[model samples]
Target: GTDFPLDAALMLQEEMKAAFASHEFQEALGALHWATKDLKIAERNKQYRELLLEVQKLIVPRYGFEGTQKGMSLMLMAFQALGYNDDPTVDANTQAMNVLISMDVAGNALAERAAKEQARTSAALKPWEEVPWEVKKVEAP
Candidate 1:
């Protein structure tokens, strides 16, 4: 069998591009923009946190780690568009940290899923045990 090496980085990049191009992501960004405008510091902080948490919930289960990473990366990339620039009201560093934590959690989940799948596959492929003597017995010579 031919072994073709997988290019993880390229695959991730493609996945990120697809996510960025999705209508759901576009709607989320639009909502983020609407949600962050004209808010007091406390309100903005709460809203931002909730929004990120919601995004994490949506991405982790379906897309796994790579998808979550792509989602967060898109969010961070659009910070300026989302009106989270150098505004004193917004804690950009903390938000970035939240994304990192989400990515780590997703990564662990993906690894665990992969391990389980591998175990299941290995068990399925195991050789059958020997037949019992009684079962194997036939007409004797």
Candidate 2:
């Protein structure tokens, strides 16, 4: 997915840091403002982590992640940030459902799925991966 707002936000952060390093007082004031905003988000991120703890308790059983590796990984992450497992044995249907349920988990996986569905319904443009492509061409007779 495209990193629209996050990338933009990060660019703003970099701009702020550069301004601060430049030692220009006027520009540095804006940079300091940016740093204050970032600090506020940092505080919110910590609270979001706590909220995720309660939310995971609800999701774990509903998604049938009760006692499996997937469940274990999720639980472990709920306590602390860590990588997750990719159970190759998981079927496509289950994978699709998980993605559907977790559409907003990242840069919005839901955007891709919605774009494809809208394209199929009419002729709207779709994400590149959803576009048709041919691997080989046959010469005309």
lDDT of each: 0.48, 0.40
Please provide, for model 1 over 15-85, each residue's C-alpha lDDT reduced to its tens digit, 9 standing for 90 to 100. 44445445465445445545555678688666655655454545434433323446556544544454554
Best of the candidates, lDDT: 1
Runs of candidate 1 exceeding 4 Å displacement = 1-6, 40-141
What lDDT score is found at residue 39 in candidate 2?
A: 61
Q: Count the backbone clashes (under 3 Å) in each candidate.
A: 0, 0
TM-score leader: 1
C-alpha lDDT of candidate 1 relative to the true structure: 0.48
Candidate 1 clash figure, as a count: 0
RMSD of each: 17.8, 21.9
Candidate 2 has its poorest 10 consecutive residues by lDDT at 82-91
RMSD of 1: 17.8
